[model samples]
Target: MNITINRAAIESIILEVPDVAAAEAFYTAAFGLGDKLRFRASEEPTTGFRGFILSLVVSQPSTVDSLVGTAVEGGATILKPAKKSFWGYGGVVQAPDGAIWKIATSSKKETGPATRAIDDFVVLLGVDDVKATKQFYVDHGLTVAKSFGSKYVEFDTPASSIKLALYGRRAAAKDAGVSAEGSGSHRIVLGGSAGAFTDPDGFAWEPHLASQ
Candidate 1:
């Protein structure tokens, strides 16, 4: 495992699903994220939550509904409906391939008509020990952007790059409206410039060669 880069940023997320074609179709129609998300074929037995969530940060509540709506139309299971919350307006949905996604926006009001513009793509890793995993990522050359004790931490990543964050395992599960009882592989490989390595939580990463 190579972990020798400076200020590593996620270049892409490769989801290992049972059917790459179907997953590609679903994600394309749902998020329209393009090459930021990749897919491969795998039969790894992953049940319950996958210990991670692909968080889509949009500009407004309307956009949140737009993305969540398309996802549900594409066969996604809604865990949380879009609504206003203390943090903002958002919702949670599980993709057809069993990947949990949270679409949200800090803005409670509509700025304008809904557009397919995503402000940020954040990959939240649910770890047993947030502080320990935060240190592990720091050692792997990812700088800390925000830290709220051990409960939450967001890494500083390059602009237009996928961001990374950490949250308590059970807390993450609760946010996704699921139980923290997942087992087997995460079935998601994060690609970045940091070289190939597996985090303490068993999240695998590879050298990002291309978008596809």
Candidate 2:
């Protein structure tokens, strides 16, 4: 089922890292997740999971392996090996700047050769309360596409745009293979249509002018 999604879509994410040049080099060599991502420089001290995860959903198992391989080669620490799960096949990696990323695909079998193509990009925010956060976003113009009680929530988005979702803090940490404890800045900024305000989980979103 589809909901009445807002026309104002999420543009890109600005990640604050200690070294912008290094991060850019790593990402460029890794997945090339597309232009939906942006970066900045900040030495802000952030520990643990940083309350979020960036996921790259691909076409097939070969694509998943391809992306994950380059990510590891680019100084990323593998949190989980690429393997098949009940839901699908995927793996997790932590960037040098302490960001967690999950490369995954719903297809277990590879139909063709591997390529650097991203079918979807997801930003999973770890919130304190899933249901309340879901309502907060809904109140701020986001429409829910999927809600699994208090466990998870996925917001509807336009094609080729950034996708957003919410998950419990502890669960998100566990999924990233990290401790569920962190303090200080999340080291992230979201440029989107939800207006200039921080969400219930301290995730900030700013109104963005659509790039020409």
Candidate 3:
């Protein structure tokens, strides 16, 4: 016999956009994302309902693709183009600032097996300098959280409430009790309908279809 319990789950990717109105318009026009919620203030975007809402919050710029050119010029590659994701369709671009943004649809459904447990997941980025990396995130849109010496810094996004930490790759390896192998050590696990990535440093991330 199986039992089911109702637990609140995280259902959206809260992305930091340069401009709220423009970003909103970009998704609507370019991807046909239906509008479900909005905010009067650019800083705080209030979302109604739960489950896979692609929440894009405008940062301090003017439009959705405002940073697109800068990102491409700064060695930022389009790891994945805006398409239908398990949660919806959109693109994932690494910003010149070293942060990857997933511009996608808010209507995508989440795909996962039923697990009785739930917890927040934190994404840690390996960088050469924590302070400088943290600064990059701050300059873009993410807010800086706690700092553990000059070796590490934490940044917060509105989506998960969990904090993403930036640290030296070697330091992160030490913390994980693994040798710091860098990006070369990472691997991608692509299954039939689900997939995850272990960046060269061996940090694992579970990425599902944006429209699963």
Candidate 4:
């Protein structure tokens, strides 16, 4: 006889919000996650969890969506805009459970089929000096990888995997495909796991742990 095991593909979830109204508006506007998938009041109530969908609450709804939106819009050139019925698009959102939402624009894909069935996660970070930042991870116990043009970097850790990029504060803004006056926050809390420090130039890095 043959046997098989079943598992949920999505390993992690992050939701961001400034206020209830804003959270409701942003997720609906950005990911089309459907408004108030959980509650009808502002009491922040968390319902039950179904499979991979984990709900977290946000105190406020205002979030930094411009950068994320721009990146998704740019990447859409190579990918496809997420559809309502898509497997990658189906998830639950709830209140009171402390839902943390990260609102980024969806992408549109080309004709090629996906070799890998599911994408686990995509991480973006800021860096002041690419060379020095890359070295720091190498020394602090991360296996570092990079693209040829110094455009992107990656680090593998036991707890988690992270993508560390070298962007000259101003240039980094352009990488995100946005225009910002100065530097953004360069820190990662790592959900209480091991944390990594950035270099003098303000390059930040994080570790991602693959869920089983």
Candidate 5:
């Protein structure tokens, strides 16, 4: 089946950390993603299941290798080493603030015709209930591109450089080979002009006004 969706863009990712300054520095040097990362500090530590992933889809295998190398050099834990997968050359990393990231390239050279190259960004959130979260975003004006019966959901966010997606909590964790015991603050913020609101998992979505 084919699904067409229209929705707003994703401007930036807001992350809540125990120390904003440190996180800013770590991400800045690690993946050169500092430009897209915004930081806020919380007085108390975070707890519970912090569910989400910041994905970078590159177009070249070399770029993927370079990015993964930089992340390791910049103090990121290589949760999953980069390698050839059915999807392409990909790997996982846990950032200093405990955020998970999947870096990959879908170039035909790496993935053949199975997956096309994605020279873009995608923000995937791990949620306790995919159906409920998907409904919440739909009610708030976001559109869906594709979805699987309460297991996964993808939004039709093309106006911005980053796309949005949702996955089952345990499923997402299992994919990353990490425990789903995240607590405290989710430290995620969705940037858009859609107004301010919070999701069921306590993740914040704030409005973004384009510069005049």
Candidate 6:
């Protein structure tokens, strides 16, 4: 579907947690995501996976090792140890605040004609219904690049630094090897020019205004 809307690339993700300080420190020092990391404390303690995963795509295998090691040392649980895969070398870690992250580097040296830096970012949300959730974004003017039968979906968001994806709730949890059951608030805020709205799964989106 062809739909165009006035929107910036997804610039930042806000993760709500029970302990903002701990989450901030873990992301900043361990994942080297300090620049994009922001946190807010909940009125009460939070539990569960928070319904999303943050993916960091680096250019080198060594970078993946270093980042995963740092995350483990900083109190993250290694859900999947780093290893070589068909797509690349990657692993999973669950941070102190119950947020899961995937770190990886492509095996292919050259990506088509372009050779860019190693670091890239993506936000993957686990939704109750992938097709419906994807339709929700399409209704908001986002375009789709690839989609599968109610299992996975990815948006064509080249303008945004951080890409957005959706997956079936159980499928996502299975990929991360985490429990499918999650409770409490998701504690997430997606920043973009898409204006303000909440997805079917209750994730918030707001416009990101750049400073003059």
lDDT of each: 0.91, 0.85, 0.39, 0.32, 0.74, 0.77
lDDT for position 112 in model 3: 41
Question: Clashing residue pairs, candidate 6?
Answer: 9-160
Q: TM-scores, in order shown?
A: 0.96, 0.93, 0.34, 0.40, 0.84, 0.85
Which of candidates 1 and 6 reaches a greater TM-score?
Answer: 1
Candidate 6, residues 1-212, lDDT tens digits: the string is 11134353576777778787788778777866544556767754456667888888887777777888889999999999998889888899988777799888886343343332346789999999999998988888778889997989988875435788999888788778788887877878887777889889988988654430
Instruction: Sort the predicted structures by lDDT, highest score first.
Output: 1, 2, 6, 5, 3, 4
Cα displacement (Å) at residue 146, model 1: 0.7
Ranking by TM-score: 1, 2, 6, 5, 4, 3
Top lDDT hit: 1
TM accuracy, model 3: 0.34
lDDT of 5 by residue, 1-212 (tens): 11123334567777777778888777776566534567767655666447887888887676677777777877788888888888777888888777788888775364332323336778888898999999998888788889998999998875434688999988888767688877766767776656787888777878754431
State the lDDT at 6 in candidate 2: 71
Q: Clashes per prediction? A: 0, 0, 26, 33, 11, 1
The root-mean-square deviation over C-alpha atoms between each candidate and the true structure, in angstroms, is: 2.6, 3.0, 17.6, 13.5, 5.0, 4.3
> What is the TM-score of candidate 6?
0.85
List candidate 2 stretches off by more than 4 Å.
1-8, 209-212
- Model 3 lDDT tens row, 1-212: 11112111112223344355654554343323232212122333322111111223222212224333334544556655444446444445543222334343343433443221113334455666677766755554456658887787765444433335677866654433344443322221211111343333333334323343
lDDT tens string, model 2, 1-212? 11235743577888889888899899989978545677878988777679999999998998888888998999999999899998789999998888899999888888678677888889999999999999988888887999999999999888757899999999998888888899999998887766798888898887665551
Of 1 and 4, the candidate ahead on TM-score is: 1
State model 4's lDDT: 0.32
Per-residue lDDT of candidate 1, residues 1-212 (tens digit): 22334447898899999999999999999999888899989998988888999999999998999899999999999999999999889999999899999999998998988698999999999999999999999998889989999899999887778999999999999999999998998999998887889999999998887735
What is the Å distance of residue 194 in model 3 from its true position? 23
